[model samples]
Target chain A: MWLLKLAWKNMWRNRNRTAITIAAVFFSVILSILTNSLQDGIFDNLIKNVVSFYNGYIQVHKQGYWDEQILDNTFEGTSALEDSILALENVNALAPRLESFALASSDTLTKGCLVIGISPEKENSITELKNKLKEGEYLNEQDFGALIAEGLAKRLKLYLHDTLVIIGQGYHGAMAVGKYPIKGILKFGSPDLNDQMLYLSLPAAQELYGAPKMLTSYVVGLENPSNLDPTAEILRDKLGNEYEAMTWEEMMPEVVQHIRTDKGSLVIIQGVLYMLIGFGIIGTLLMMMVERKYEMGMLVAIGMKKRKLMQLMLIESVFTVLSGCILGMLASIPIVFYLNRYPIKFKGELAEVYEEFGFEAIFPTSTNPEIFLTQGLFVICMALLLSLYPIVKIARLDPVAAMKK
Target chain B: MNTVIDAHQVSKTFNPTTIPILAVNNVHLHLERGEFTALVGPSGSGKTTLLNLLGGLDKPDKGSIFINGVDITKLSPNALIDFRLNNIGFVFQSFNLIPVLTARENVELIMQLQHKDRREINERVETLFREIGLEDKLDTRPAQLSGGQQQRVAVARALASKPQFVLADEPTANLDSKSATNLLDIMAKLNQEENITFIFSTHDVRVIERARRVITLVDGQIHSDTAKVSTEVPHTAQKRTP
Candidate 1:
């Protein structure tokens, strides 16, 4: 108890020095927490944009269809299968799509494009497709009119209510051709998707393709996208071998790889930051040891063992660092909360670059408790590791020579 | 007379490779219980080095040092620290009390290091502070206390563990005449009344004049050893009640 008191008093002997050391630790912790929080928040937002905006958290397709993607490989969209999946917990909505590549032609331009068929109401519930309409109106179940993307309309020089022809190969080597008026023009954040996509009602597409009651894949939405893995497992088990269920992470491994690579680079940056923080703490410790050389010698010469002295120094350092960590955490809470609520909007080139990748150009901080706690613990461990300097120095101190100094 | 400390042909050298300085030559000495002795010499004559050797603060290059029959030079570094904590006390010329601690806390530190019971530590600190005329300044830190007061606190801290002897290295070197005299009086009284042994290394005539025995060093060897004849009662003959 008295040793604690002594350590406390000693730490305050040079108030300015102690305060500066503590401030260094405090600010470093805040920077580290904020950096990690912002990075996590941005990645999470990216996932929501790329996956949940339309791709769905998980998808079910015919076993050979994913590899071949031909109309002959399509399966029947059975009510029993839909009901079984919907009955399982966490399955929010499902949209069945019949997709194929075809030639889209207008007055002067003929473009190779992707043709998609959807049930308007079911697709609306899952992907909120109706809200993406930039011109005219959303599709109805019986309507044979097509929904063309804004980029594709601009390339074709077509207007709303313009006639367009879609030509493609149908199932079993049948020739597929269709003529429909453009009912709507939809906008998309990604230029790749916007320049090539076309949507039609399910029955209209089945008639044109000459294959009734057929679907390429069922896109399944979930209550939480993070729960995709376990939900996909349950769905796969119920569906048996005819179909394969895959999460977005598996279906879009490129996106997952990009996030992983970025996180790896971030780890290296954080390691450098930690090294700077460690060296700052070590510098202060070295100064402190030099200043208290005589006092340490006197204590030892008066029969205080070196181990006891080492213990006292260790206690003092821990107290200082823990105090700094707690203060840093307290100071960061409000800043992080405010930043999360009102994210920083980016403009100019960066905004355009983000739009190109189909992400919102805003910076948001995460409010995860783990970010604060794990970062705080990491900085504290660094402080403890730097304390080894004093321990080794004291253990090897020559008391008689120190007293003379 | 019981020998409290025995030094057998002790020697110490400094900068042995370049300008080899023999700090303490081969010398033999013995101290009895309850004796107030002083080692006096000119500058660079190795009085302080000899004191360090006898107090176990420095090791001898050539011979063994025994305190109460245990050869301290043979003990490990950790064991030597334990030995010093229980058997030897130290007082420095600059009054080296830890500046961050209060006078009472400084005195209690040694006893605490000894792992003494709380009640015993409190009792001993109280008595020693009072005995050294520092009871009024018990809570004062060294920085807040005068030089004389700091030295008194140092003395009290040294004796708090009730060691076999106290080694004071020029304790009065930094005090004014009045403060030095007062400090000497306190130390002299403690020796006479409590039968505590004190060995000091000093160039101060005031301190040497008050010593019952003086050992003078010249060129790292004892030049003369003399004892003063007392006209009054031998102070140690009078029994003290604690």
Candidate 2:
């Protein structure tokens, strides 16, 4: 206890030095926490927008359908299988899609586009397709009219109630042709998706493709998409060998790869930041140890053991680091919360670039407690590591020689 | 007389490879209990080195040092540290009190290291402070104390754990003449009243005059040893310096 008292008093012996050291630790801690919080916030937002909005967190398809997504690979889904999947925990809704490519033609233009057939109610619940309508009404199960994205409609020069022709190869090389009135025009955040997507009711698509009661994939929504892996595993186990249950990471490895690459770069940045902080702390400790050399020698020569002196020094450092970390955390809370509430929004070409990639150009800060705790622990661990220099120095100190200085 | 410290032909060398300088060479010395001894020599004559060896602050390259009949050279580093904590005390030339600690706390530190009972430590610190005429400055830090008061506090601290002996290296070297006279008076009184053994290294004539026995060192060997004739002097013989 007296050791602690001595350490506390010793720390204040040079008030300016102590304050400068503490300020270095404080600012570094805040920078680390805020940087991590903002990165996590942006990643979370990206995942929510790109994966959950359209791709679903997980999906189920025929074992070979993902590799060859043609009309022939479509499966006849049984109601019993769907009911079993719905019974699983966190499974919110499933939209079965029969997807293929076709040539879409009107009076002025002809373009290659992806044709998707979906159940109106299930698709609406999963992708919120109804909210994306730019014109006309949403498709019903009984309605045979198709819903096309606004970009595709503009290219084809078609309006609501106009007849558009879709021609393609059906299952087993069968010829597929259809003329359907446009029931609705939808807009998409991604220009790629907007220019190439057309949706029809499942039965109408099955009829046009000369295949009845077939589905290419089941896009599964969840109550909590963050628990994607475990849910995917459970689904895989339940679905057996005929079907493959894959999470968004597996189904769309491109986005996962992009995020992983970004994270790797961020980790390098964080490493550099920590190195700078470590060097700052080391510089301060070096100054302190150098200044206290004579005092330490005197203490050791007076029958106070070197180990005791080392303990006092360590206690003093921990007091400094713990105080700095706690204060830095406290100081960062309001800034993080405020940034979270009012994110920095981007405009002009930057906003267009973000929209091209299906993201909004706003930078938000995360309010997750784990971010602060992890950053605080990292700084403290750094302090502990840097403290080894002094401990080793004291351990090998020659008191008789030290007193001469 | 019981010998409290025995150094058998102790030798220490510095910069052995390049300079090969012998700081203390083949010196033999013994100190009895209750003796106030001074090691006197010119600069670089090995007085401080000899004091360091006797206090177990440095190990001699040759020969063994014995305190209370136990050979200290054979003790491990950790054991030597424990031994020093229990048996040895030191007073540095600069009155090296921990600048952060108060006068009372400085005196209490050695007793705390000994794990003495709290009430006992407090009582002893109080008595020692009162004895040193520092009762009024118990809570004053070293920076706030005068040179004489700080030296008195250092003395109180050295005696706090009741060690077998105290080694002071040039204790009065940094003090003004008045503080030096007052410090010598306090240490002399403590030595006579408590029968505490004290060994100090000094070039100061004042400290040498006050010591009961003086051993002069020249070029790393003891040149002369003399015991002063007994003279009756009052406890307050040296006038106080404020």
Specify the highest-DockQ model's number.
1
Worst 10 residues of 1 chain A by lDDT: A45-54
User: DockQ (Cα-based) per candidate?
Assistant: 0.69, 0.63
lDDT measured at residue A214 in model 2 versus the true structure, 0 to 100: 85
lDDT of 2 by residue, A1-405 (tens): 999999999889989888887888899899999899999988876775567666778889989888888888878977987898999998999998888999999986899999999999999899889988999999998679999999899999999999999999988889999999999999875566778889999999988898888888899989987788999999999999999998889877888887889889999999998998898889878999898888888778777788898899898888888888899999999999998999878899999898777676888889999999999999999999999999999998888778885
Model 1 CA deviation exceeding 4 Å by range: A79-95, A100-211, A220-241, B229-242
Please list all clashing residue pairs in model 2, or write none if there are none: none
What are the TM-scores, per candidate, against the unseen true structure? 0.86, 0.88
What TM-score does the A-chain of candidate 1 achieve?
Answer: 0.83
- Model 2 TM-score on a 0 to 1 scale: 0.88
